[model samples]
Target: MMNHKKILGIVLLVAVSISGLFAAESANTENTVKKSTIIYTIKGNAEETYYTMMDKPIKALGYRLPDPRKHVNQVYKEQYGSTTLEVLSFMTIVNDKKVKPLLEIDPKLAGFNPFNLVIYKHQGKDETVISHLTADAIIEMLGITDQKVITEYRKQMEELDALVAKTFPSAVVSHGTYEGAVENAMMHYEITFDRPEDLDDYIDEIQEKVDDTFTEKGYIMAGFFDYKQGKPDLLPSYDAFWTFSLCHFPYSYTVFDNEGAMPEVAVFAPCTMYMYIKKDTNTLVIGMPRLANWNRFFTMNNSKRMDFLNKLDKDIPATFLEIGAIEVK
Candidate 1:
């Protein structure tokens, strides 16, 4: 009983609705990029008041806060004679148990194993920002697939997150937005060397050389942690596992503390390079998060900052090769 024109109108209406639905779905997919970093903005500037309190709680979480670089902005202000940052600092913390299961699966997991928990505040701002990478980011970035280990690690992070919330009751939590995971998130390399009669002797000799070499090249040995020696029970299967927090004084100053630069990026600063030697194995593995991650995760768009990022990406591996290590893949 319906007219032909009416039937045609009904068909047109259905087609338009379907098209709109598809368009909406596409837009949502694009907008749903995964977040890789977390930011907590807490009111009040108590300076090192909160920073010093973390030591006890961090130890309770089976983690350690090594080489706490508090008042970094003050150091910048003193050396550079001026600065934009008011409270930019870092506490490179690591949990051995979190990396124990993942380390052998992918030695590169050690790259972010000893990561930074950064605190920053902008000049004239009353709030302090504490930030770090999400556990999801770590699992994805390392290309890890073991769900059991992943779940355990995430839970560990949740415990740490709870500590933050309880410590700063009014902190506003947020995430660092990005397009998603970057390609080749970590830089990994390995070197096969002769097995020595005493492993400690080899470690001592090589460590001294590594320290001297980086220092000569104007790099700061920000901090060092030895899991095999420091926490023997945590690494039951490894002969050696250690991480060095590497920092380029000038580069850090320019990107984080200098005028017109991003201070929040310090969350990834003092890049921790990890190295390990498995039990009775002659191969020594090395890995770290590539500097390229800084630009992609943080969307730092300045040309000068990009140059620093690119140069470090190239320089880090080059330095490893220079220090008698073979590049693995």
Candidate 2:
């Protein structure tokens, strides 16, 4: 019979080998966009055009642009002592019916359920730039492998594209590369709570506490998803789970409005912070993607960007501790 140590070594080697293969595949696809990222340029000042898009909505497009600007002007002042350009970003949530089935297939799909639209102009620029990451890029980055889901996602995105063209008749629309940034690594911070006398009540309390902490820390709670509540039939195996999309306005402005900042990085925006409990377990798990991944693949090692992300990576866990959640060892 094989010794226990030898068996453990073999399992470890296999896990590393699998991880290496996935990394290699990601490397091969870097900087190569499967779908064209469409950019629309209007012949006018950036603020005017940004408002136009904000006010105008093509209902036929099957989505509505939520009116929330991160206020980059103030963000810039706070971060860099002064502001240089105008920047605003918003999102369009596709019809819930259209996105529901996709989410039922896989909850991870929630990351792109409400696609983003960004409008901004760099200092000294004559025109505002409007852009969005391609549907193919969104699908690929989330690692969606279902052919049916991919086809449906592409179709819905195409509908949005048509609406943009119709809404901005005079604007110039062109394709560019923006597949997605490489997720070289992910940061996971989780806390497991002992099963309370009333499990449901405890989960709700925990949720409220986490949300409160995020808001107090200058983070925006953009969207909340109760995966278990929505998909009891599909997720029968899961005891209970949920994810909240959180965003820090200053952090968003830093990456979106700054010159040379890759607007495509917004794909990770309102970072999806997930909390869940596995079936038959009393443990509550919470975590979010590390902001550093933004530098790894998209921002290209910007010091300020890295600093902002690093702070988030550290502070989030500390806040969890403050709120009476224990970090998973």
Best by lDDT: 1
Which tens-of-lDDT digit does each residue in 1-329 have in candidate 1? 99999999999999999999999988786567777778889887855656655778778888887678878888888888988877877888887767677666656667776788888888888888888998887777777778776887789888889888888778899998666335788777887888899888888877887888888888999999887765566676788988899999888887986657687787778888888888889988888888877877776657888888788789878888898988776
Instruction: Report how far residue 267 has shifted in candidate 2, in Å.
Output: 5.1
Q: On residues 1-329, what C-alpha lDDT tens digit does candidate 2 reach at each position?
A: 99999999999999999999999888876745554356888766656545554554545455554335455456566777765565545554444556656655654455555555766665676776677767776665566778888898888878767766776788887765545454423334456667877678877888888888888999878877665664556455557766677788788766665656555566556576666676678776665555665654455547777788888878877877887766543
Task: List residue ranges in candidate 1 displaced over 4 A.
Answer: 1-31, 101-106, 230-234
TM-scores, one per candidate:
0.86, 0.67
**Highest TM-score model number:** 1
For candidate 2, the 10 contiguous residues with the lowest summed lDDT are 180-189
**What TM-score, to 2 decimals, does candidate 2 have?**
0.67
